[model samples]
Target chain A: SQQGEEDPQALSIQEGENATMNCSYKTSINNLQWYRQNSGRGLVHLILIRSNEREKHSGRLRVTLDTSKKSSSLLITASRAADTASYFCATLLRDATNKLIFGTGTLLAVQP
Target chain B: SAVISQKPSRDICQRGTSLTIQCQVDSQVTMMFWYRQQPGQSLTLIATANQGSEATYESGFVIDKFPISRPNLTFSTLTVSNMSPEDSSIYLCSVGAGKTEAFFGQGTRLTVV
Candidate 1:
């Protein structure tokens, strides 16, 4: 089962603008990672924020995690037409095994 | 990070037929998993295939419906049986090693009619 819910289930933005998506989970986690899927196929990993970390950045992608609220957010700055894709947040639970539970995605459409 | 090679990227199959998707990793991995993603939906894990052991299935998933095989640490296969329109989805294979997060492969896009 999916453990997180991401909203603004759909969003539209002009190229060069910023796109922000929020994700919330219901359980404790060891780490939170964000991924981008193109055309519903292979997923490209963007960034991973450990439980102890509050925020992380990779180029234009910024991810923040709030353990107290069990929530996280991804901020993509200067979005491009190529950046248009379904973004998902996946969680690595605090359990002993290494299973990743995914969240309902946010579809971001960047108009060129 | 280990690299994965998955084949049969996309297929259109008839109802009641089955399709087997293969994933081969460049390096040995301890845990390999299978996931299903419906159009415009999140991914749901189906099972964990551990080398030298029987695959462990998650709730709402069973071996008869989605059988998995892990012949070695670097190779695994997932078979979607008795395909239906409802089974049309992207099936992904993932691998995890050490302390890193699980990495995914280019999913197999299945379409059943």
Candidate 2:
């Protein structure tokens, strides 16, 4: 069973607009990581936020984790057409084995 | 970060046949995992391939259907035995070092007919 659920299964916006995706999980996690996948390729790691951290930033990507709410969000600032892809959130549960539980994912389209 | 590679990028196989997918990492990794992604669905973990030991499968997956082998720290193989059309999906291999996030390989796209 999947532990996380991402909201707004699909989203569309202009190239310069910011795109936000939210994910909610049901279990306590050691870390939550985001990934991007192109049409038929493998996934690329975007960012990871530990349970103890509230927010993190990498380049134009920002991720926030609220342990109290058991949720997280990913914000892509100043998005580009190249940023159009499927985004997924994977959780590594505390004291669990090394496997990650992935969410359903969100498909984002950025029109140029 | 680790660079992982999978063999037979894509294949079309006949039903009742078997196919083995290989995964290789550029550097040594402590843990290797297999996942399946059906069309328009999320990825699901299949099993954990531990070096020189029996693989640990998830609740819905079993060793008889998706047998995994890890002969060393950087290489693992997953064989889909007695495959059927329903087994067609993308198989991905992921590697994780201690305290690091998992890194994925270019998944193997399998099509059973």
Stretches of candidate 2 exceeding 4 Å from the true structure: none
The alpha-carbon deviation from the true structure for residue B97 of candidate 2, after best TM-score superposition, in angstroms, is 6.1
Q: How do the residues A1-112 of candidate 2 rate in per-residue lDDT, one tens digit apiece? A: 7988998899999999999999999998889999999995799888999999999999999999999999999999999999999999999988658769999899999999
* RMSD list, candidates in order: 1.2, 1.1
Which 10-residue window of candidate 1 chain A scores lowest in summed lDDT?
A39-48
- List fnat, each candidate: 0.60, 0.60
CAPRI quality of model 2: medium
Off by over 4 Å in 1: none
Candidate 1 C-alpha lDDT tens digits along B4-102 = 899899999999999999999999988898999987789999998999999999999999999999999999999999999999999999987225656
DockQ (C-alpha based) per candidate is 0.64, 0.68
| TM-scores of all candidate predictions against the true structure | 0.97, 0.97
